[model samples]
Target: MASDLKVHSFEEVAKHNKTKDCWLIISGQVYNVTSFMDDHPGGDEVLLAATGKDATNDFEDVGHSDSAREMMEKYLIGEIDGSTVPQKRAYIPPQKAPYNPDKTSEFVIRILQFLVPLLILGLAFAVRHYTKKE
Candidate 1:
């Protein structure tokens, strides 16, 4: 059940499928997240967790989380299960203009942490400009 609310255990997640670019069928449906395995922000660990298993709970667990789910949406494209498999659309990195803060705070925090020194340097420059006497 893609909409199931019950969270799957980590062990269950790990048993799903670990293969780098393989698709798994569950309950007559196909979920083609294989191409996204290497591109996942958390790296291969997240994709490995959902291999070879019914990943409804895993989807809930990750999407329920702020950052994980937000990141997950970037890779989602409806259900890809069955003989009517959708065309393999080229992966397009979604560009969000003005950079929405709707992304997970953890990602935001990581970015901010990386930028803090530059921010401080800018502030120092500003302070020096304002305080210098003629």
Candidate 2:
């Protein structure tokens, strides 16, 4: 939640490229440059090798467009510092909603559920019999 929008230079990002999905949070923007690493024209090794250093330099290396830079601002949540990065949890499964049983409420709900259909069926039967007689 820090306000200082740190823009990382490309050199710094290159240092930490080996870390796989190592991200740089800059200017309140988050860029997952992982997929772009291997195909970089500047030789993938340079970015791949920047595995551990501070990536302030890498971000600066890739200059931003006026519109892109403005859009990038939205993704920045904070830098991938040791504290934040290490604490980040791996991909977790989606959590299913818990079922809470309330006996009194459930009983009433079940009775209403069953009674509604039965009521409709009885009404239909009564209507049909009266129409046939008529």
Highest TM-score model number: 1
Q: Give each prediction's root-mean-square deviation over alpha carbons.
A: 19.7, 14.2
lDDT of 2 at 74: 54
After superposing candidate 2 on the true structure, give the runs of residues whose Cα lies further than 4 Å from its correct spot.
1-30, 61-78, 81-134
What TM-score would each prediction reach against the true structure? Answer: 0.32, 0.30
lDDT of each: 0.56, 0.57
What's the TM for model 2?
0.30
lDDT of the structure predicted as candidate 1: 0.56
lDDT of 2: 0.57
**Residue 28 lDDT (model 1):** 35
lDDT of 1 by residue, 1-134 (tens): 45632333333333446555544433334444677767666677765665655555665655456775455544443343333433347989988677656667779888999899999999999999999999
Task: Count clashes in each candidate, considering only residues at least 3 apart in sequence or on different chains.
Answer: 7, 22
